[model samples]
Target: MKPTLLAVAHGTRSAAGQRQIRDLVAAVARRRPELDVRLSYVDVQQPRIGDVVPAVRDAVVVPLLLSAGYHVRVDIANAVEGTGIPVTGTLGPDEVLLRSLTRNLPAADAVVLAAAGSSDPAWRESTHEMASKLQAHVAYASGSAPKVADVVADLRRRGARRIAIAAYLLADGLFYRTLHRAGADSVTPPLCLDPTVAGLVLRRYESALLTTAAGRL
Candidate 1:
């Protein structure tokens, strides 16, 4: 029997956000019906990772998160501890996500890559690297550095008109809504329901399975 592919995400209060995640999970299931794909959350929703991990006999936990921050390092690590189940890295800082971001982006004089920020320096750096690749200024909805609104205001001060915000989020929620009020002319949608994202989830699952197999040999 194949091990379960447990996709875990940071939960949101937004009903739309919840639906988007469910839809993304459905997309993954459609792509590979043979695999047992399940969904759980880390916060603000039911079926938290801690509760879900114990129920699965054998599985690989793939974080549906963009960066390796507090949730990935602490929350998930604590849940799967001593379970002998492998865990994959976060989904972003990858070319597949970059394509998704670029494809959704609209034309503007200035672009701000707005992310759900974290206190972890590594997370901040990883997000910065992605923003650098897109050639977009970096801002956060919360946690580290200059905020989304501040970046927009700064750009306006610098004579940039029609500034755009490229949402570096996996699903829409309060964070995405905040981007709309960030004083930008446009804000791209979150990276939800993108077929490429489904592909990336599969890749993470396969990669973890291979690594675990090699370790046993």
Candidate 2:
């Protein structure tokens, strides 16, 4: 049986948003040619997650979503629950991602770990440790007291020589745009259709489908 690999994305209205998901699909296809590769959005896009999952005969759902927020914990979960596909964790904020984020900072007096926040405390809380551990400044794009702007302000207050903002976004779009305007000396590139990220998706795909649950089919 060819285990399907669903590369699910949180969709957007921007042309770039759809394009990003397609680019991601192409990248995932390169690594795992044998598996069925499918793309779908969670909102404001075609082929919603509900529609995307059924197309895959049997598969593991990989939420391209950044954090385990209401979307992953509730929205996405409710969507795929009975489908019998084990969902993997969100792709960003992982240890591997920090490598790319830190690479953006050639030298940083402080850093803002910016993300598209969610009201879900679990999601928000998940990022705190990583942000604090970095030893640079930290903040979010969506929620909490020290937003990106405030974070940069706090850093400047401390007289940071250079401030580098790293986006926790899955693709290039509004969140990245907002993070830039939030007052920073510089920002890491928006996570785009990169090979490494695609590779990570493929890794999740392998583990999801090869495990006994996926094998039970």
- TM-score against native, each model: 0.97, 0.90
Tens-digit lDDT track of model 2 for 1-217: 7777776788776677668768878888877778878877677777878777766777878888767776777667887888777888777566667676776666777777887766677777767766765555557676565678987887788888788887767777776788779888887775655557787787776676578455677
Model 2 ranges off by over 4 Å: 213-217
State in Å the error of residue 88, model 1.
0.2
lDDT of each: 0.91, 0.74
Worst 10 residues of 2 by lDDT: 129-138
Instruction: Report the Cα RMSD per candidate.
Output: 1.0, 2.2
Q: List the residue pairs that clash in candidate 1.
A: none
113-198: candidate 1 lDDT, tens digit per residue: 99998889889989999999999999999866799999999999999988988899999899989999999998888798677899
